[model samples]
Target chain A: EAGVTQSPTHLIKTRGQQATLRCSPISGHTSVYWYQQALGLGLQFLLWYDEGEERNRGNFPPRFSGRQFPNYSSELNVNALELEDSALYLCASSLGASGGYNEQFFGPGTRLTVL
Target chain B: AQTVTQSQPEMSVQEAETVTLSCTYDTSENNYYLFWYKQPPSRQMILVIRQEAYKQQNATENRFSVNFQKAAKSFSLKISDSQLGDTAMYFCAFTTMEYGNKLVFGAGTILRVKS
Candidate 1:
């Protein structure tokens, strides 16, 4: 089966602009997760979407939001992007709830460069 | 809040040698999950190995293995018969149901395997 896939391997945006990154989960997966890997900040959880619902989000600002479609694909939108927002945005997927022992498979990540 | 820490910012190992990356986590949840992810230059996060907190036995996958200490709250990755392909950024992550399945990742350790 195909692993998680992300689009726009690289994206460029300016300060105050908006950016949208997409991710397609693996076949039969129902839970999608978003993460931001920023310099010095490490990999921080952004959002969690399961069964077309927003389950949880990290300490990121409200400007960082996303949604999951019925097909389990997810889209992360960043409004009023800032220079610090430049980072590799990754998407991961799990078979279901991902609460217990489920393993999350990740995508190649989308490198967002904010000027 | 749950936090993961990778003390070694960088490490190197000769081909056919072995190296270990240390990680420590802080969490109050009795049951959770720990994972080791490898990100190569390609920027794809690959699952190296994972261990369930309740499982006493360490997890091993091929040449990669994890030494998990529940009481000490330590989880370290051991790579044996290292190869050049093993050069990458290794991350330690933690997750529990109380956190809605979001992963808390470490700052990451860069491992360089030389021939």
Candidate 2:
């Protein structure tokens, strides 16, 4: 299996700008998860998309939003990016949203640097 | 709402030795899922192990194992016979029974392995 794959390994944007990160889930996976890992911090849940619907979102502001496509791929968009937004954004995929039993596979992640 | 905590910010261990990372989460849900993820310098998040709250047996994956205490809300990861490649940032996460739930992650612990 190829596992999960993300695009544009690195992205740079200025403060107040917008950034878009893309991810392709593993084959046969129907759930995609977005997470943000700021320097020296853990992975913070951003959003969860399954079956082309926004299932859940994190405590992050509305500026952090994303969607899942028909193919189960996902895109994470950060609007009004702040310097603190510089971090690694990861995408993970699972068979479904059935709690712990659903094994999740992650991608290399897109490193967004907000200047 | 749930919160995960990793008390150790950083830890180092010599090759062939063992190291344990601590994690604790608070949640009101009776059933949930917990996981440990490893993010290497390449920034790829890999699922290290998982433990279901309802299951008393600890989850293990080869050299990686977890000590899960449901009542205490504690889940710790122990790596036996660690190698230099074990260096990475380890994060503990939680997911509740609520449909389409998002993961709650800890601050993470940085593990460094030395030869």
Give lDDT tens digits, candidate 1, residues B1-115. 6789899999999999999999999999999999999999999999899898989999999999999999999999999999999999999999887888888999999999888
Best-matching candidate per lDDT = 1
Clashing pairs in 1: none
lDDT of 1 by residue, A5-115 (tens): 999999999999999999999999999999999999899899989899998988999999999998889999999999999999999999888436478899999999999
lDDT of 2 by residue, B17-80 (tens): 9999999999888898999988888887888888888899999999999999888989999999
In candidate 2, stretches whose alpha carbon ends up further than 4 angstroms from where it belongs are A98-101
Error of 2 at A95 (Å): 1.4
What is residue B112's positional error in candidate 2, in angstroms?
1.2
Candidate 2 chain A, poorest ten consecutive residues by summed lDDT:
A96-105
Question: What TM-score would every model get versus the actual structure?
Answer: 0.97, 0.93
C-alpha displacement of A104 in model 2, angstroms? 1.8
lDDT of 2 at B97: 59
Considering every candidate listed, which one attains the maximal TM-score? 1
For residue B49, model 1's alpha carbon misses the true position, in angstroms, by 0.9
TM-score of 1: 0.97
DockQ of 2: 0.69
User: Model 2 chain B — which ten-residue stretch has the worst lDDT?
Assistant: B95-104
